[model samples]
Target: MKKRFWIAIPIMAFGLGWPLLAQENPTEPQPQHAQAQAQPAVSAPDVKSPGTPQLDAADLEAWLDGYMSGALEQGDVAGAVVSVVKDGRPLFAKGYGYRDVASKLPMDAAQTLVRIGSTSKLFTWTAVMQLVEQGKLDLDADVNTYLDFTIPERDGGPVTMNDLMTHRGGFEEGLKEILITDPAKFITTEKYLKDHMRPRIFPVGKVPAYSNYGTALAGYIVERLSGEPFDDYIERHILGPLHMERSTFRQPLPEKFQDNVSLGYMSASQPPQAFEMITSAPAGSMSATADDMANFMIAHLQQGRFGDARILKAETARLMYQPSAPHEPGFTTMAHGFFSGPINGKRLIGHGGDTIWFHTDMNLIPEEGVGFFVSFNSRGKNEAVYGMRERFVEGFMDRYFPDKGNEPLPPAIQSAQADAQALAGKYRSSRRIDTAFLKLIYTLQQSTVIANEDGTISFASEPGTKYRETAPGMWRDPNSEGALHVSTVDGQLTITNSKNPVSDMQRVPLAESAGLNSFILFGSIAVILLALVAWPLSWWCRRLYGQTLGLTGRDLVAYRLSRLLMVGDMIYLLGWYMALQPLFQMQFDGFGTALDPLLFTLQAGALVPLIGVGVGLWNAWLTVRSDRHVMAKAGSVLFAAALCGVAWVAFIGGLMSFTLEY
Candidate 1:
């Protein structure tokens, strides 16, 4: 639910036939607080340079109105909240549309609590840093030392708290109990992490693979050291100090704030979904009013002080600001917990949060003492919130802290076609399962880089954006000024760009390219189905025409055996598809324990191709060597080859995996 960029498909475009939710004064925003009036700019110690526009509440609110009005109407989103803080003062806060569509309850910037997803991690990180400020936690020590449960060490070393902070713990993606409406599936962070511990696919402190379990592990550590629940520890140390009164990490929403929580929707045109329960609560489970979020953001912007309260010390906050992994001039890096980057000529630290329905983004400019937070209660048609958040934040930056122009291209741009060509290929995200059936899903979502007819290249992820080589291996997008840094690592090209370093893209070999995999998948299915229909139809046609019995012999036996193999292989493929169809629909119910029997059946059925393909090869040999008709020989060879492809695909795709870890 982090809205990982690896997925090219829409996030929550749940298909429904219901009419759009009705609203009174649909175009006009209903606010708990009226539109802010023009007021003098809040006193900031940092003065603006010449020609900088004054950021006042009236101007900010008016600008937000022009944007959100059309955005909600066009995108079919129900409601949203936006808050901006300048220096140590809140500059603007407003809500747009309805919080409860059925009751026509308007969204309230001060009262409507919206689930802020992974933004919850920022609070968790603050809690951990506070403990580190005391002597309760060690940032560099093995995390296993802090836990009652053991997390086995991966290659190089045991996962340290720093590794979890930087998201370099190398844990494979955890999908079970991620988002569930079933309260029965709801489990604590400790229970989920302990029961469903993931294997480390990458070495410890190496490769950026986003892991919710890692964050949960960190949260659990805080839970153990503080002698309290994760949620309570967060509220007492971080939220309480920051005075984020409306916020709570509690799953069901504390009883008092329950009525104020906004209903999340796949789309405003569709019915509302039940409250999303995140088992990995530490990673992404917190709801708060936009105004409360502003307070939290103000603390970070002012070096962890909010009025009389302090959540993180100045030194400790600065430590969080330090990049855990810095790249070349215009590439990506991760701070201790924040995503630190060079954006619009300013150093920015921020994090994006996403749930199944709600989408949220938070950003803070330490140098400017400016913080911005926005949340959408609906994913909208085609998950429009994802692009909306990025464009909104960047638009704000361009409007206020305007960049002077694009960065000057390096000398390498003069003749960097060769390097650009070298970078053009299929790339897969490193946050992938190494050995599980889930890898098949990752394969389909792999990214591609194509060398344009011109000297520029483009990433499939950022369509329409062309990047020219600004440095030897750095391709800079002129539009966004984001650069992608590609280099060979361990004999394969791994790319780290201006995007967050939660994951990097690695070059995919041609044999394992998604294109090839898709080709084999569809082509084999087509061939198998064609063979299946023809075998039955051809025999019926021969009998209808009163033809001979095809001269019964080993040739007949081979033909019959081939049909049997097709039947078994086809059944195997379809069975797996039936089991996995839910995932294709972007639902995770099929991954729960309830589907274990179906999964086991599919895994056991993998033996179909394992044995059938061998028998198919023998049948092909028997038919071909028997001086059969030219058509018969060709059909036998093609049939055998098609089944062989299916078998190979099954093997490499991990359909043969007997475990349900994926």
Candidate 2:
């Protein structure tokens, strides 16, 4: 019974948790596989070099208007605030469309408060660095040293502050209670951290999975060390010093600031939605204007000083922008908190954020003394916000830093047949769940890397796109200059896009891929539903014709049990699916209580279908031995196999677990 329970739990859990199970195993031994490329260097742009610029103010504005205005009109986004700072001064800052469409209130770049999502991590990282500068914290020291609670150490080692900053802490992703709708549900940082500490999955300092829990932990540590609340610490040291008077981390907008807060919308045409409350406040709960964000950007671009106020020494500011961990050899790595990537030959550091309704991006070209910030008030479909950001940044760089004929690309390798074939497999993103139903979503999003006949690799997720060998282990898109580096990390083949290392995906074992499993799962469900309808309809027709089911021994029992198991499994699947609908609806206040019974029912009910595996075989064997119709024998055998596949797939997907730990 205990074994049966263990098996039953994950069948449903895997339905959602398969992708999470594919997350990197931190404790797994790292093999000494020789990598193909030298470590990529961080190119420090000439800070004082007047970079070549072919665009005047008019050209820049015209290009931006064309892109932003059209995107706002097409996407579900209602309004946006854009700001560009060059040489520590605003080159352009303005609002597009209306913040409150019903009231027809136009956005004010400097006054409208918009939730900046994970870009709030910049403030948290900035606080940690400030503490480091003041000798209150150590970057390499065990983070547990400053925390009231211990972050369980894995084989890699105790996670240091630097690991948290670089998102290498190896903490499993937690989403169940991360985003809540009610303000009352928002607990203090101390309580929230203690209650929601996630499992440490990967070995410390190895996997580059972005961890909101790790960042929030950093914030809690700041709260402990500074002897101030996390919200107060930022206000006193960072926001106050920079005079970002309108910016805040507080939920439930303060009385004076309420009128200025923009209504968050799900779509440009839909009615406004409730303001979001992220339980991990430090990781993402920031509300600030474009003008306020510009000040924060200027402080970093100027090496920690905004006008007369300084947040950090010039050296500390530089350290904050430096890469923290290099996951792939010769690939741009994650900086302290910012993601390091290249845009048109320039090395830049930045962060992007999104809540349910708002999308925000803040980027800085440290060498050019330039920064860009943009925020949208509505949660748009089609990813228009992200598309706009990518285009704007690339356009800005192309116009300002016109590429003069530069270094020649490494000669294209004529042969990479073996390597490309070896790389052809399914890869899962590290930023996924290992314990929750949300893993199902990630599983569907897994990318298939296919080795083409032309000695190039294509990704199923990005159709009509192929990456060809430019150098050993390096592949470049023929249509675009973007590149990808393929190498073995932690004994697994990994790929990192030139755009963002944080979005890298690692290859997984063949058995772990969900393609075959998902196909079987859906196929078996369809077979069962068909059998249910056919068996009854055939029985009714036979009764009318005065015919009957022959066989009154184990064959009859086997047939009855087979149908029962199929129906039982269907109920389990449909039950869990219905229970999960509210989870996706953003109404999560009573999720745990609501999910408990469904989990319990599924756990016990899963064993009912396990019996079908055997009964199905018995029925198939009997039909094959008897003078039954060929279709009947074949259907019996196929149905049994489908039953076994469904259960096995469920188990592998992490749906078999009995616990509510997720």
Candidate lDDT scores, in order, read 0.76, 0.72
lDDT of each residue in 6-80, candidate 2, tens digit only: 000111110010000011124432211111011211224543236554334565567667767778778767888
Candidate 2 Cα outliers beyond 4 Å, as residue runs: 1-61, 327-330, 405-408, 478-481, 582-593, 625-627
Q: How well does each candidate superpose onto the true structure, as a TM-score?
A: 0.91, 0.88
Best-performing candidate as measured by lDDT: 1
Estimate, for each residue in 6-105, the C-alpha lDDT of model 1 and write its tens digit: 2111222110000122223434323221111122123346555688667788878777788888888888888998889875777788888888888888
Q: Model 1 lDDT vs. the true structure?
A: 0.76
Candidate 2: what lDDT? 0.72
